[model samples]
Target: MLKIEELQKRIDELLLKAGLPRHSVNLCTAPVGDGTPYISFENGKYNYIFSERGYEFFRKITESTDELLYWIMSELAYKIAFKYELENRIEGRDGRRIAFPKFIELMTKINPLWKLKAEDEIKKTLSASPYDDSLYL
Candidate 1:
């Protein structure tokens, strides 16, 4: 299982890698009731809430520190990307579009290292795990 301290450390590392300030975001886990994870920006800080179901899902698939780190970093990428859009007034195609691809593209342009590192980390995690049959559950 991934420890909370370890997760926090990984999150901090990701923030550093993205050139974001440490105080820009807060990561926490709680019983969110909806079984869905969410990110909220308020008071100049981003609150990332990982629900109980999300925690269990990570615990089931993340067998190593690298895998867990990859998972957290990926989520951070999304949150940071969205935060950037909101800050810069970058709107989506239909105003309600997911914009993940655009975010990834923007992130890649901002920091080439992130994409390369994320790819390596994901490849390592997938190779180490081989298969996860609980994806449907």
Candidate 2:
């Protein structure tokens, strides 16, 4: 079984590799009876909510660090892309987004595994939570 402290360290290391600040994303487990995944950002930090299933996914993914890193890149990049899209929608910016693509590119650079896991594959991994739109982006 993986300890939370070690899990936190792997996350922090990944963030630092991506040139992001440690604890910039607060990783948390969902409460009992609340297994649906969720995510939010405020106070300059991302609240990454993980249900029991999500945590298990993390544990399983860790056996292969490349897979773990790739998954993290996908989720974080997608979340950032969603944030930009939401902002653009609110601000009525031009319907052009260069950032999202670059975000994915950076993530891929950090851990190149797009051929192994596409966006569709990511969607297939998570449950049918209403939060999919935000999470899968």
Highest TM-score against the true fold, candidate: 2
What Cα-based lDDT does every candidate model obtain? 0.51, 0.51
Clashing pairs in 1: none
Per-residue lDDT of model 1, residues 1-137, tens digit only: 44566567766766676676774444455556554554333443334455564353322233455544444556656676576556554232321123344455534543565567655544575577643434423
lDDT (10s digit) by residue, model 2, range 49-71: 45563353222223444454455
List residue ranges in candidate 1 displaced over 4 A: 29-60, 83-98, 105-137
Candidate 1 local distance difference test against the native = 0.51
Candidate 1, residue 76: CA error in Å?
2.5
Task: Quote the lDDT for 125 in model 1.
Answer: 55
Superposition error at 25 for model 1 (Å): 4.6
How does each model score on TM-score? 0.43, 0.46
Stretches of candidate 2 off by over 4 Å are 32-69, 85-100, 113-137
For residue 15, what is the lDDT in candidate 2?
76
